[model samples]
Structure formats: structure tokens, C-alpha cells
Target chain A: MQLSTRNQLKGTIKEIKKGPVSTEVIIDVSAPAEVVASITTGSADSMGLKVGEDVTALVKASSVMIMK
Target chain B: MQLSTRNQLKGTIKEIKKGPVSTEVIIDVSAPAEVVASITTGSADSMGLKVGEDVTALVKASSVMIMK
Candidate 1:
């Protein structure tokens, strides 16, 4: 909703992959491909998420260290 | 790290809140507080998160809808 939020990325659900243990979800962020980061919701569930759904990806940038 | 995956919640970092733009991260999960679901990492950053860090909270539990 608010892009001003530091680690929050709101987007529409592009895909949902359910695994035996975890689920992989992809979101289509508004930022360009450069600024946009692909986050993985590492879990599977029978509720809430679905294709075309709007959701927020809360990322703690610190946890997302750039490996160089 | 692999608590059956469904809505992956790996515990480590305890607190990180930096405002002005957005950054509020708190992760101390272990499935005790009744399935342990307290995820919020909106966003703020200088590098990677600190404060006894260890991060992994990727939940897509159907957007977590539970209303009565």
C-alpha cells in the first residue's frame, strides 16, 4: 500500500509453487527489475495466497546481505 | 531452519526498527506462542540487519486470513 515503507514490497502474486515441505511464491513488484528483488515465501499452505493476489513482502534488508 | 516449511519461520534476529522511510524487523520465532506467527519486516536499511542477526521469515499462508 505504502511504497515509502523501507522493506515492504507490495505486489501481485504471479505464481505459487507448493512443495512437499515448503511453498515458493513469486510476486510482480512495481519497481524496475533492478530495484525489484525476488523474494521466496518458503512454505506451502491451503489458504490466503493465490495467483493475481495482492500481498506484501516484508524484507529486513540487513538479512539480505549482498554477497560479493 | 526447516520446520516442515509450510510457512517457513527461521528464528534469529530479535529486533531492528529504523524509521524515516521504513524498517521494522522482528524475528524470534520457535513455535511456542501458539504456532508462533509474528512476522513484520517492512523495511529500513544501511546494510544487513543486526541485533543478534539470523533471518528467514518467508510466509505466504494464503495471506493469512483468519476472521471471525
Candidate 2:
């Protein structure tokens, strides 16, 4: 799908933490670099995200913050 | 600074959009893959973020969600 956001990292799922309302997904983007994303529990389940699976973490530029 | 977040992408500043209170920073993570992050104007100014500067996009897994 064409995403409006510019950053799209190729990653592999490394961990999944399911919460009552939200789910935490850890993705191994590159060695020693991982991406963690919190999404709704229902969305996680529906997506069937599991460890070792390839997925894309979509972040709108609006949701990203810059730090020095 | 060491962050608790897991996703950190090494990139170069590509664009900057400043608003009244917030700023939009876009980074080129890889070829054709860019990441957009929204940060406060104060923070952006304090950090002295500018184009062509090297940066790391830190994303908390909790702030990340999964997609198919």
C-alpha cells in the first residue's frame, strides 16, 4: 500500500506483547536496531502478528518526534 | 543520550516544517525510505535541528503498531 508517511523500514518481528487494550510489537529492523510499536489489541490479533514474521511499521511524520 | 525506546533509525535530515508550537522533521532512512517525526518547536530549536544533519529516529515500541 502507498503510505503517506515517508519512513518505511524493512524489519522482522522479534517479539509481541499483548495487552488488554493495546499490543506492543518489537521489530528487528537491522542488527541491534529495533522498532517498537503500540497498536490496539484487536488490530494486533486481526493482523496475526507473530515473531519471525516480516512486517512494516508505519509511522506518520506527525507521530514521530526528533531528539538531539 | 541513551533512550529506553527500541527503534532508532540512522538518517539524515531532509526537510523541516515549523509550526506555531510543533515542528515536522523528515529524515531519509534509506534510499527512497524516509521517516517523518513531529517534535515541539522548543525542542527542535533547542536541538538546533537543520537540514543535512545526522540524526536518529527513536520510536518506542508502545508507540508502534503492527500492520499486515
Candidate 3:
């Protein structure tokens, strides 16, 4: 589970929920609420996450690249 | 994206770094530094992420479940 990438941020597993096939995990970050809002609008689930659970949401490194 | 699990978090892509095969994305959340630390310990890359990139890190809903 030792990731080797460089980009690292700090957050908490604010919530955790279960679904028919998969489980959901949420992290509360320290960035702008709006930014998180936008990401959530297209990246979050529907069953509603839990209130407390430590987890990390990993995005594939290649999926995102520098714009400028 | 359009992830539909349950747990939703709020954070910013603080950094983005490139790797030999994939890119690295870093998100800054609003949770405990320690929690994020542990997760990052086993969840981040090594190529060094960017400084300002809005992204959403999605974890499989089933990967996380309710403890109680």
C-alpha cells in the first residue's frame, strides 16, 4: 500500500457508507469549499457517507496532467 | 467523472507531478493531518504533484464500509 507518487495532501475520512456492490468513502479537506463542491458534484456518491472514517481517495496519476 | 457511491469529500488538487507511466494528483482536505498522513503513507505517488489543480480522487465504494 506504499504509494510512490509525489503529490500528497492531508485530509480525513469524514464518512463511510455501503452500496449494493461497493462501499463509499469521504474525506474532508482543508481547501476551498467551492473546489471540493465542484469535485463532489461529479465525483461523489449518493448513499451518503459516514461521519468518521480515515481513508484516502486515490486518483490515477495519468488521468490528470498539467494544463500550463 | 460522475462517481456515484455515497461518501463525498471536499479538497483541492494542491499538486500534480508526472511519472514514467502515470501522473500524480494531490488533494488537500480539511481533516486531521494525521489521518491524511496515514492514508498518504500508503496511498500517494512519488513523482511530486503540481501546486494548483482541481481534481477529485475517487475510491471504490466497496473498498470502504461501515465499521459500526
Candidate 4:
């Protein structure tokens, strides 16, 4: 799929934590680096995300904040 | 500063590419992984982002997407 965002990281599903309305998915991009994504529970369930699955984390540059 | 987003990656500024209205900041989070952020040039100049500066890349889970 084409994405407008420029940052894309390929990683495997490390963990999945579910909340009432949101689901937290931790992706192991590398040894020391991981990307945490909070998506809707409905989206998560529909996607059938599981541990050990390879997923790409898409982050829009506009959504990224640079703090000193 | 407290942010509502959960994903925070600590990295060093590697390069800064400027556009008319937006600035693209590429950060090296790890050896192979980099996070690119696009923010307004005004905010970029006001923040004075430079190469070799330490910055945190904050991504709101809401803005993160997982593609299988």
C-alpha cells in the first residue's frame, strides 16, 4: 500500500497489550529499538495481529515530534 | 514534558532537508533504523535543529499504523 508518511520500519510483533478501547502493539524494529503503536481495539482484532508476525510500522512525519 | 503518546525513541539528528513550508528531519535511532519527521519550517527554525543534536522522536500511538 502507498503511504504518505516517509518513515516506515519493518519489525516483528513483540507483544500485544489490550485495553478497553485501544490496543498497544510493540514491534521489535531492532535489538534496542522498538516502536510502540496504539491502535483501536477493533482495528487490532480485525487485523488478527499475533506475536511473531512481521508487521511494518508506519509513522507520519507530521505526527512525529522532535524534542530537544 | 508529559505527552499522551506512548512511543518515544531517543536518537541523534543525522540530517535536515528543508522545503518551502516543511522541514524533513532524519534521526538515527539505531544502526539501521532511522526516524524521519516532517514539521513546519517555522517550528524547525524556532527549535534550531542541528546535526548531532540529541532529540527524542515522539510518536503518538494514535498516529502509528501497523501493516501486516
TM-score of each: 0.26, 0.46, 0.26, 0.51
Interface RMSD, in order shown: 12.6, 17.1, 14.9, 17.4
Instruction: Give the number of the best model, judged by lDDT.
Output: 4
How many backbone clashes are present in model 2? 10
Model 2: docking quality category:
incorrect
List, residue by residue over B1-68, the lDDT tens digit for candidate 2.
44333333544344434445433334434422345455555565556555555555555534554333
lDDT accuracy of residue B39 in candidate 1: 34
Clashing pairs in 2: A6-B34, A7-B34, A36-B61, A37-B61, A37-B64, A38-B62, A38-B64, A61-B36, A64-B37, A64-B38
Please give the TM-score of chain B in predicted model 3: 0.35
Error of 4 at A38 (Å): 1.6
Q: Candidate 1, residues A1-68: lDDT per residue as tens digits? A: 12221333446768878866345666676864323333344542534467676666566522331111
Those runs of model 4 whose alpha carbons end farther than 4 Å from true positions after fitting are A1-31, B1-31
Candidate 3 lDDT over residue span B1-68, tens digit each: 55433233334445434444433333445543211112231122332322333333433222322211
Task: Answer with 1 or 4, whichever has the higher lDDT.
Answer: 4
DockQ, 0 to 1 scale, candidate 2: 0.12
Q: For candidate 4, write residues B9-68 as lDDT tens digits.
A: 554444434444433334444534445555666666666655555555556545766555
Model 1 reproduces a share of the real contacts of 0.00
Please give the RMSD of candidate 4 to the true structure: 18.4
Question: A1-68, model 3: which lDDT tens digit per residue?
Answer: 44333323334445434444433334444543211112231123332323332334433322222211
Give Cα distance to truth, residue B10, candidate 1, Å.
17
lDDT of 3 at B61: 22
List DockQ, one per candidate, in order: 0.02, 0.12, 0.07, 0.14
Q: Name the better of 2 and 3 by TM-score.
A: 2
- DockQ score for model 4, please? 0.14
